[model samples]
Target: MRTACFIDGYNVFYGLVAGTSFKWLNLPSLIQHIVHVEAPESQLTSIDFFTSGVKPSLASRGSQSKEAQDTYLRALIAKGVVVHYGRHQLEARNAPRFISKQSPPSRLDQVAIWKLEEKETDVHIAISMYRLASRQASLPAEERVQQLVLVSADTDMTPALKAIKEDFPDLRLGVILPHREGTKRTTPGSLKNHSHWMRRLVTTEELAAHQLPERVPTKKRPAIKPEYW
Candidate 1:
């Protein structure tokens, strides 16, 4: 089966790699391995990674964090993963303040905050998936993508999956949640309901085995792994 993967990069980062040693991920290799485990005949044809650039002012490591993300993105590009960039919007907003677990948030007890939103990623992924499915409808059977795999636990993508499942019955859908093994994150029922199969967690061993090399060669200069990563 010819398969295409759509990855929610922001979702993957916070769910799997953040605060972990696996920041330097080899996404294609890891995804291929997982897909093969689910369907031995699957041939990964393409990877579309959707994400927003880091805001250096809000990042924990400031500019270093942004540089690390840039380097990693360059390495991913070198490996043939097509990246789609969304943008971050920083704005002053007001929201209910957190008190205690037992206390409900009251509108009167609001606080000023800097709200950072990642824009257009969900819509982009949905549109891209639907467009691919529509395009495949015109292709020769052998040239069409037989499978569509989504790598995210976000329920926002459920509608797209459901639409594909309804409109393209021949195309198999798969979902891979970015939750790492040993974590207690719940499997999203909506995503699983729309997908033909759902992989619940990614093993640490898989991440350890699929890290990018310290240096990745580019046309201009080599993209090296960040020292802090």
Candidate 2:
């Protein structure tokens, strides 16, 4: 069975890699592990990773600089991970801020701040999943994708998965929940309910085993791991 993997970059990062040293990930090996252990008969044909680039001014908000992110993205590309970029919608708005308890009860502080929201990643992932799943209709039976794998815990994808499954009853659907250690509920109920099978991603053992090399040799300058990563 030929399979394709779609990963939501921010979702995976927040759920799996945040506050950890496992930022340098080897996506192909991880997918291979999923296919080998769960669906032994399946073959991984491609991996689609969706994400938005970060801004340097927002570094205080736990975002990496564009240069650092680019290096990591380059490494992934060299490893055959297809990356789809989305833009971060930056906005300024007034948000409430807490003041000292001694302040008047009726008084509240409205501070102006900049907020960054990642857009289009979820849409891209959902569209890609359906598009790839539908390719089985036109391609030769052997060459078509027999299984569609999602590496995200976003419940927003449930409707798309359900629609695709209704159209392609024979296509296998799997979910790899990107939950990190200390997480209580890894898989969202809606996503899990729609998937034929589900698995937890970001285990310590698997992450350590699937890290990209410190230095990924590229045709141009090498894609080196960020020193602070």
Top TM-score prediction, candidate number? 1
TM-score of each: 0.98, 0.89
Candidate lDDT scores, in order, read 0.95, 0.84
**Lowest-sum lDDT 10-residue window in model 1:** 133-142
- Whole-structure CA lDDT of model 2: 0.84
Off-target runs (Cα >4 Å) in candidate 1 are none
Enumerate residue pairs that collide in model 2.
none
- Give a tens-digit lDDT track for model 2, residues 91-151: 9987766577776433266778888888998899989888887777898776888889999
Top candidate when judged by lDDT against the true structure: 1
